[model samples]
Target: MGDVEIRPARSEEYAAAGEVTVRAYDVDGHLAGDVGYDTVLRDVARRAEQAEVLVAVDGAGEVVGTVTVVLPGSDFAEISRPGELEFRMLAVAPTARGRGIGEALTKAVLDRARTLGIPKVVLSSLEGMRGAHRLYERLGFARLPERDWRPFPHISLIAYQIDV
Candidate 1:
């Protein structure tokens, strides 16, 4: 409840970070109870080995949020292109919403992009996630409908991009 810090998730914190991810998605009805994607979210360890897993910890040291940042060509890079860094699985624990943890975690990724001299950052979000969309907009991300796509018939992903 004091201050939250966003940083890379340690190997031992991967499972907990994954749990945060699923809980956030479930509360939003994005992929609640979907074992396939839930398992994917919980596999932060695999993500850490491939991309980067960032976690938000409360002043008390509890893991309250997580997001996965993918390099341009990583397997997790769904919508990122050259000179861009893409992030996904941005989730704040349901109990932790409205605490600015989500913003902080997102800003962390943006900050990294700046440091790496990346020209832009992009991501895909499920439709109807108004709160998340608001956050993206507030951070200067613009809708990239031209890039919005559906990987599967049942799942729609809207794209957003911000020049860093």
Candidate 2:
């Protein structure tokens, strides 16, 4: 964990970026047999066209993490609206855990929201991702209970937001 560079993902890194995402969820047991969603996680190239795809790279120039910053009307956006930006598919390589990669990637999204003059930033996290919840809360994102939702019957997504 040395000199992590937070920046937009290069076109060539899209495939590796997708692997980082899918692998993180798979490792954490979050990839619950949802073929469509799993396929979506592997489509960072497609996501890049609809939103800003940011990556956390190590000193060795390896992609260790990624997150998609989605604007209000982007296809990946869920809880965001006018004056708000939402981030999705945050993932950090399992081998890179404890290196602050996830936090750095999240801050990149927050930074983007600030630069865009957005009033708020929003995101949805799977309820089972307690570790992610801690990081989100530590970064000042408060739970937005009313925005909680479920895309799948058994998988609940909890919302969080922060005024920027």
Estimate the TM-score of every prediction: 0.96, 0.97
**For model 2, how does the per-residue alpha-carbon lDDT over 53-120 read when each residue is reduced to its tens digit?**
99988888888999999999778888888999999999999999998989888888888989989989
TM-score of 1: 0.96
Give stretches of model 1 more than 4 Å off: 32-35
Top of the candidates by lDDT: 2
lDDT, candidates in the order shown: 0.90, 0.92
Q: Which ten residues in a row have the lowest lDDT in candidate 1?
A: 26-35
- lDDT of prediction 2: 0.92
Per-residue CA lDDT of candidate 1, range 38-129, in tens? 88888998999899899998888888999999998898999999999999999999999988888898999999999999989999999878
lDDT minimum window of 10 residues, candidate 2: 31-40
